[model samples]
Target chain A: MNTIDHHWQRFTLRQKLSRYAVYLVLVLAFFQSIQSVEVIPEFLLDAPEQMGDMFSRMWPIDFAYYPVAVHDAMIETLNIATLGTLITLIFAIPLALMNASNIVNSAWCHWISRFFLVSSRSVNSLVWALLFVSIFGPGVIAGVLAIAFRSIGFVGKLLGEAIEEVNMGSIEALKATGASWMSILLKGYWPQVLPAFFSIVLFRWDINVRESAVLGLVGAGGIGVVLDDSMNLFQWDRVAMSLLAIFIIVILAEIVVVNIRKRLI
Target chain B: MAGIKSVQNRENPFKHNWFISAIWLLVVCYVLYTFNAMDLSWGRINEGFGHASNLLGRMIPPNFSRWSLLLSGLIESLEIAVISSICGIFISLFLGLFAARNMMPSWVSTPVRALIALCRTFHPVIIAILFVKSVGFGALAGILTLIVASIGFIAKLFAEAIEEISLKQVEAIRATGAGFASIILFSVMPQVFARFIGFSTYQLDSNLRNSTMVGIVGAGGLGGTLFSAFQRFDYDFVAAILIVIIALIMFGEFLSNIVRRIFR
Candidate 1:
């Protein structure tokens, strides 16, 4: 079914060499521009010390604000993540299937799906959060939407890849039984790839949890809102307390996700 | 071959399935619809672009008046990046190894693996903001943010590298009287060290890029200046700051390549 030709190897070598040359040219162009550019503002000598003093002054955090508001805000951050992940999951599953190379059974479908996934992933989530904040008027909803949108890109890409790795033999067998494409996918492909799909989803959920925490800085609500306010107010101690809560929540969430993942695998 | 042909025949088997095409078309349309609903109009985009261009124009001949300020901020950012990378690489080395299922017990590996996941859960900016808030704005917060980010990224890569290694050599080492530590040093390290180096260098490059951003959240570095520039609508200064950040990232990328080559 396959032919090993010497010419093919030569062609691949030529391709690799061209790629290397392009990389070299790009690097050279970048450096050339950098060298010519004027050094602006000039580097500060005592900036580090100033930064250090700022940090040292804020030492020994104030923990008295622990009763209800801070705790509730922390919970809201977690909820934002959970809701965002859930929404992305609903959107991603169908999108992933459409993108799945083997499942889609169409070259145009595959290429277009690939284009969408790649473009979505090219930008970082923070950029999306900023854009959403401007449009949605800075609230939990904006943060949730940003997280959900970003997670869709992440989950869709992984799930599509997972679908491609499924044992296609069963799919063929199902098709041979005169089953429809939908049935073959449901009965054959879904069960095999379900484990990996769920794992990726849960893993992304953990990531979204962390992301939602910071969405508030851009006005996408959560603990970040409080953190931002404290910073603006120059309340270093309050800032310290907020950070402690974030660290604790992240660590706790990490433990829970790890336990769940361990049990699943 | 005949059975395969029959299976293929039953499905639409068109080079482009109509259903998938419709789905994509619908998605694109939905995106467009959302844009319209959100009022992300051409006028707003045009106005933003106009402001951006004017800012870029002003950024030319960057103000060398604040040379000392710029220089010190650059130095602190570089330090924060380097220190965090060192801390991150150190933690990643041990955590990655311990988390590798093939290299360690389920009980031992699971916790370490979980820690890595937790480390990776947050964006560096969010984490930096947290640290700035918690630790009180400065290089320390920036460093902590980057260190956590590096650990998250490198540990995952390291664990995967370890998992992918040949078990035969590990087993051979185990058969010998070498202790677990020695076995890891000889067998596991040899196979994964190069990948670990690659990951470390990449993490360093990433940390450098991120260090500039942490300052935006008041964690330290040039970002604070940049953010203030943005707030003041000092487009020229903002442009100057952005150019410097870009240059820093490019330099980091170059340095990482050199490090990778040296290790290789």
Candidate 2:
């Protein structure tokens, strides 16, 4: 019995070593990558002091800025999110249908739709903003377009998956009743996916609110324009105020979205 | 049969809610207001399209003459992403365990949950700006920004995954008189490991994308190069950078897909 126990212990020890060996290799690779990035220890050590200094400079938040510039910018940001999400939903519904494998029987069509979604999603909204800013010559128009284009892929992809996952039984039942394709889609697919579609749109809007707030950095027009100006001018107090406003807005959006999703889903 | 037929006939197939319609009406009004505020016009749009065409014409045949600069920036971005993902995933693993309400006491879990939420509140761009200011700018700032973003994202999902795990296995391990560490290792880890892999790979993909953008704020990466090119009106170089960025993102997506497949 003692010999058997000793053998078991040795085997467990060997297993542990082998398991940790993989983590060891990963850690080694992490260190090698870190070297390329040149994250010096000295700079890391000084980071805290620099942070403290910056915080000190940012103290006494500029409440005066909030009533005028920040307020208008904040409203514009909200408008951007709302309108952008609405536009995305309009475009995404058709794209989602085209991309849904269950809806679109043709393989080529499905692949083409998927390709469009992937390419759109691959490019960041900021990059899109940059492109639109060049074309539109800066303003809320560019911001709105950037947000709408960026959101199409995300909304389309999720909605497509939801559409594909709808109960087939109901669809088949509608089809067997000699229903038209439009009726089948409306009566069969729409009801099942409406809940998910609403939730996705709301969630995307919440995200877009966060994104559009920063679109002004690229001259797309929003609160980010004020933020960019403040940061560049080294107006630390105003920067602090803007950041606080952003934090509050994001939290509020989160709460509203969660409550709505709960009620809907 | 007669009663059922009467009941079916009495029920409306479509139930319309006035409340929902009112909400939609409000939404439409708000959209119209926003449109009016933005001062959108067809003439401006047409002029914009002409400018767009000119820009596109210049962007054709991307110039890769500064290949070395682009290559180095791309490599740095890649490094920042990999390193941050490794660090973020490692830290999130432990934080996630602590944040799990089922695994830890409320007092312990609440603060960790709050920390995760706080991390998530600000965009990576805002955080990158802060890091760039404090850390004197470079790949280090970008890496730090992504690490915070990753923790905020993965920790929440990871904790939820842990909460969803069957406690029966954990209880059984405890019955053997195992220590906290041993039970966590032998039981809880097995259940959530696959999902943890999924979250980590997704985080890696996101970090890769974010690393490219952080450089726009001087945090270091391909974005810095791209931003400078745009400033110089080097549209060809900008086009080249955009092409590389798109390819990099797609490659990251492909790689993560394989990782997910293997794990799944």
Question: Which candidate leads the pack in TM-score?
Answer: 2
Predicted candidate 2 versus true structure: per-residue lDDT over B1-264, tens digit per residue: 555454555766657768878988998998878778878777888999999999999999899999999999999999999999998999999999999999999999999999999989998999999999899778999999999999999999999999999999999999999999999999999899879989998999989888889898888899899888888989999999989988999998887786666555
Please tell me the TM-score of chain A for candidate 2.
0.89
Can you tell me the CAPRI class of model 2? medium
What docking tier does model 1 reach? incorrect
DockQ per candidate = 0.09, 0.58
Interface RMSD of candidate 1? 10.3
What is the iRMSD in Å for candidate 2? 2.7
State the lDDT of candidate 1 residue by residue for B229-259, as single tens digits: 6566565555566556666776777777865
Q: Chain B, model 1, TM-score against the native?
A: 0.89
> lDDT (0-100) at residue A236 of candidate 2?
95
In the range A1-265, model 1's lDDT, one tens digit per residue, is: 2565534442356555654764575456445433432222222344456557656756767687655457777876886787677768777888799898776788887777665664444334554565455455566666766788878878998998898899878888889889997778767887788679768978898878777887778677788888788778887777778878988888788788889889878
Model 2 has a DockQ score of: 0.58
Q: Per-residue alpha-carbon lDDT of model 2 for A109-170, expressed as tens digits?
A: 89888888887787788888888999999899899889999999999999999999999999
